[model samples]
Target: MSEIPPDLRYGDSHEWVRAEDDGTVVVGISDHAQGELGDMVFIELPEPGMNYNQGEACAVIESVKAASDIYAPLSGEIVQANGELEDSPELVNSDPYGEGWLFRMIPSDPAQIDGLMNAEAYAGQLARILHEGGPINT
Candidate 1:
């Protein structure tokens, strides 16, 4: 089963978002995503100042199993990216929700966050994926 923390919001595409104290949102691939990816080898993150619409592909993650696009869960401009991942992509496999987080963004509309899936919804989606015997559409 995938780890779905109750505090974070999730996208059907597998991106997770955590609202930070300083008004930025931390973004990352979910545990289910990294697990399906298998031993991440590289990540192409968005630039600090770049803006993206919700549902846009903002980054790329490659692993031994497959390569996947990381989508923006909300419309926002990136504030900072995790430079550490360029040197140690395995962090995505090791701790996807914590140290492996991809980027931080200042949301264009904070209220839009409410539209994302909660932990229970995300878990149900993960369960469906597992029952189907394959990863989600990437």
Candidate 2:
């Protein structure tokens, strides 16, 4: 079973968002996503100051199974990237919600975060795709 933390907002592409008190939001792939991808071998984090619109592919994560794009959960400028992943991509598989975070961003429209799916909704979608064996509508 995947660990779906109750407090985070999720994107259709399996990216998770955690808003920080500092006005920046941290971004990472959901635990379910990491599990599906298998062991991560390489991760390419977006550079700080780079901007992306919601749903845009901003980073790359290569696992033993395949290489996947990590999309932006909200329109924002990346403020900080996790430098540790460059050296330890396996952290993605080990601690996806914590030390495995990819980047932090300053949202272009903070209100847009509210438009993302909550954990319950994401869990529902996850179960639907698993049980139905159909692709998510991302």
Instruction: Give each model a TM-score.
Output: 0.95, 0.96
Candidate 2 lDDT, 75-99, residue by residue in tens? 9999999999999999988999999
- Please, what is the whole-model Cα lDDT of each candidate in the order they appear? 0.91, 0.91
lDDT per residue (tens digit) for residues 1-111 in model 1: 678899999988988999999999999989988877789998999999999999999899999877788888999899999999999999988999999999999999999
Cα displacement (angstroms), candidate 2, residue 93, comes to 0.4
Report model 2's TM-score to 2 decimal places: 0.96
What does candidate 1 score on TM?
0.95
- Candidate 1, pairs of clashing residues: none
- Compute the lDDT of residue 4 as modeled in candidate 1: 87
